[model samples]
Target: MLRSLDVLLLIFLLVTAIGVVCTKDLLGAAIIFSAYSFTMAIVWQQLGAPDLALTEAAVGAGVTTVLFLIAISRTVRREDE
Candidate 1:
């Protein structure tokens, strides 16, 4: 069950990462990146590194996502043609 959960989390991380890279909208990409970071935090937790998982969640998902959202709010949401 644990291994299966890990696999599922990893798959979500991969899909979110790909979505982040493939997204055309900057805001959407930022959102997906945040999801990727959150999924990574879960993976770290499942791997038995609680400290790393907390740090990843706080910094990678929380702080980084906030920063990205702030930047996105100040700029255009879409790429210029």
Candidate 2:
């Protein structure tokens, strides 16, 4: 069961990473990147690294997402303009 969950989480992380890379919209890509981080945290937890999982969740998912969102907000312009 644990191994299967790990495999699923790995697949989810990979798919989200691809989505982040393939997306043209900056905001959408940023969100996908965050989801990738969340998936990674789940994987780590399944691997019995709770501390590492918490760190990944906080830094990878929280801080990274905030930074990407800030970047998108600063660089993106109105599509109408």
Candidate 3:
């Protein structure tokens, strides 16, 4: 069961990473990146590194995502102009 979960999480991480890269919209990419970071945090926890997991979750998923979103929000889209 644990092995299966690990595989599932790995797949999810790959998919989210691809999604982030393939997305044309900055907002979509930021959201997908956050998902990827969150999955990485879970992977770290599974590897028995709780400190790393916490840092990844806090910095990668939380602060980084928020910063990306804020930057995206402040930008003017060419289509809108």
Candidate 4:
């Protein structure tokens, strides 16, 4: 049962990864990247690495995504100009 869930998480991770890669908008990509982090956290927990999973949940889902958004905001521009 647990292993099955892990497989699901991995699948979700892959889908989110493709979303991140295929997206042309920086903001959209950053949002999907956060989803990637969440799926990764689940995979880590399934692998019996609670510490690493929590780290991913915190940093990957939280800090890293925020940083990516901020960086994108700074470097990317809107077409309204």
Candidate 5:
């Protein structure tokens, strides 16, 4: 049962990763990336690595997402053709 949950999380992570890459909107991509990072943190926690999970939450989901949002806000929203 636990292993199945882990597998589900992995699948979610993969989907979020693809969403991040495939989305044309920068803000949407950043949000999806944050979701990906959060899923990774959950996986790390489930794998018995609280420290790694905390790091991922702080760095990947927290700092990186904030930075991406800030950068996106500072720049234009639409992709240039």
Candidate 6:
């Protein structure tokens, strides 16, 4: 059912959001954040906003994730140093 799917997506979104916050590794956090963004895009689609969903998928999940990963790759963690 659509309602069940919406609930599942919401639950996944919550889990990913918490994963992003609780993750200690920068790379892992970025990955989780991307998942969160992707779930948000699905939610937008379910809400009948395809344009916003497309933008969120492209910018939020795609571009921002890549940028975060690039920034993470260039930086050295204090623990590593």
Q: List the residue pairs that clash in candidate 5.
A: none
Looking at candidate 6, the ten consecutive residues that score lowest on lDDT are: 72-81
- Candidate 1 per-residue lDDT over residues 25-66, each given as its tens digit: 988899899889989988988899999999999999999999
**TM-scores, each model vs. reference:** 0.89, 0.88, 0.87, 0.87, 0.91, 0.89
Instruction: Decide which is better by TM-score, 2 or 5.
Output: 5
Report the C-alpha displacement of residue 12, candidate 1, in angstroms: 1.0
User: How high a TM-score does candidate 5 get?
Assistant: 0.91
| Overall lDDT per candidate, in order of appearance | 0.89, 0.86, 0.89, 0.87, 0.93, 0.91
What lDDT, from 0 to 1, does candidate 5 have? 0.93
Error of 3 at 42 (Å): 0.2
Where model 4 places Cα greater than 4 Å from the true spot, the runs are 77-81
Find the 10 residues in a row with the least total lDDT in model 1: 72-81
RMSD of each: 1.8, 3.0, 2.7, 2.9, 1.7, 2.3
Kindly list the per-residue Cα lDDT of model 6 for residues 1-81, writing each as its tens digit: 569899999999999999988888878889899999999999999989999999999999999999998888899532245
Off by over 4 Å in 3: 76-81
Say which candidate scores most in TM-score.
Answer: 5
Q: Which pairs clash in model 2? A: none
lDDT of 1: 0.89
Clashing pairs in 6: none
- Residue lDDT tens for model 4, 4-68: 77788888989999998888887888999999998899899889999999999999999999998
Off by over 4 Å in 6: 77-81
Per-candidate total of colliding backbone pairs? 0, 0, 0, 0, 0, 0
- TM-score, prediction 6: 0.89
lDDT digits (tens) for residues 1-81 of candidate 3: 578888999999999999987888777889899999999999999889999999999999999999988888898422234
